[model samples]
Target: MKAIVLEKAGGPENLHVAEVTKPCIKENEVLVAVKAISLNPADVKPKYEDEMLSMMYGKERPVILGWDIAGTVTEVGSAVTNFEVGDKVFGMVNFPGIGNAYAEFVAAPEAHLAVMPSNVSFTEAAATTLAALTALQILSGKINKGDKVLIQAGSGGVGHFAIQIAKNFGAYVITTASAKNKDFVLSIGADEAIDYHTQKFEEILSDIDFVLDTQGGKVLENSAKVLKNGGAIITTVAPDLPEGVKAAAEKENKTITNILVHSSAEDMNTLKRMLESGAIKPNIYKTFAFEAMADAHREVEKGRTVGKVIVTI
Candidate 1:
């Protein structure tokens, strides 16, 4: 099997295309012939020194990095009841662990795999795994009809999905993005798009029922100020709240949650329904060939991609 392997967590140069041994499936796993793989912010952890990576690389063996994949099941273990040979499947495979999705084949647990939407292409399905799952999990049951929700980094992968998901449940969604992407965000379902470059979001939006904070740091700190009493906040990064936000939330009685998305077939079925009904759509910002996996990682590292970036195998 061919794979992009990383020997160390340092630079894109460390990632290279190589022929590696094919992975074998466990009793509870399925062997997927990965057709397309998508990149995320987590894939860039190697660029920073001493940063705690959500995914680990093997020091002795070549580490394959990636979690989102849309592929076909070539073989299934005896315990795999939900999927079988020739099944088109997609999911975030083994997230928070060794997903090893950046390859021609991957051994995915049955629980982490979902049947691909029949109407969606492999590339589109691949684009929706981890990022879409994050958005779906964070906003699921966290907001309701007529509620006002605020999402940060609305033009990025998770942000884009969050905006569409919030709107699906009839929530009025406000989001922050660059001036260049303001119209793009609105077209995708955001009711209001605040240009983070020139305007202050906290000053303009108030009494938000939910705040989906994709950008951490001061963004997380200032999110509390815009929420109404008892409003809730969910951040994708930095589980801990800054002292200022904590004080504001403590005084105002607002709730907070930090999102670390988990894999679920039920949630994937929800996405399947959305896709089939044309409720939520994927915005693939870019696509790279299998040999260009390093280039894809470089693009994601810039942190400016408007949506998902995928590599076709």
Candidate 2:
């Protein structure tokens, strides 16, 4: 198997393509011939010096880092019941073990895998898993017909999904993006797209039922001010609840939350159904060959992508 390996935590240069041994499947795992893989912010965050030294390498176990994968199951363990050899599947991989998905093969637990929809392309399936699930979880609060919702970074991977998902549930959605992306975000279902560069989001929007804050820092802080009382502020970035959210929630008695997206097979299934029904689709910002995995990561790190960036194997 040729994999982009991170032998030691460092910069993008440390991620080099090399021939590595193929992973062996456990009794409940499926061996996938990875057709495509996608990048997320989490892929780089865990490799930060403080995080790696304190949590991962500090434990004496070097790890492979990939989470979102879409591929074909070439083999299945004896205990695997949900999938079989030659089944097309996609899902987020279990972290810290065989998340070596930037390769030709990956062995993932069957419970973590879902059948890929026939109508969607492999790259779209690969890119939608983690980011889509994050948006779904963040916006899980009450959604009623004609209700208003806000999505920050609406042209990015998670934000695009959030806007579409909120719209699917009959909510009017507002989103923030660059001036260049305003039209793009609105076409994807955002009722109004705020240009984060030219104007403040809080100044133009208010009385929201939910706010999906993909950009944190002061954006997270400013987002809270625009929500109606008791409206939720959900974030994938800012692992900690932003102090502004906490302070404002304290002052006005609102609810704010921060979540590190989880890899969920069930959510992947729902996403596939939505795609097949034409209710949602991944907006791919770009695609790279597997050999260009490092470049894909660099693009994601820039934080200006219009949608998910995929590495096709």
Question: Which candidate has the top score in TM-score?
Answer: 1
lDDT per residue (tens digit) for residues 127-224 in model 1: 98899999999999899999999999999999999999999999999999999999999999999999988999989989999999987778887888
Please give, for residues 174-281, the per-residue lDDT of candidate 2 as tens digits. 888898998899888888887878898778787887778877778877877888887777777663655655876768766776787676777778888888998888
What's the number of clashes in each of the models? 0, 0
Per-prediction TM-score to the true structure, in the order listed: 0.96, 0.93
Off by over 4 Å in 1: 47-55
lDDT of 1 at 94: 82
Candidate with best lDDT: 1
lDDT (C-alpha) at residue 188 in model 1: 94
lDDT (CA) per prediction = 0.88, 0.81
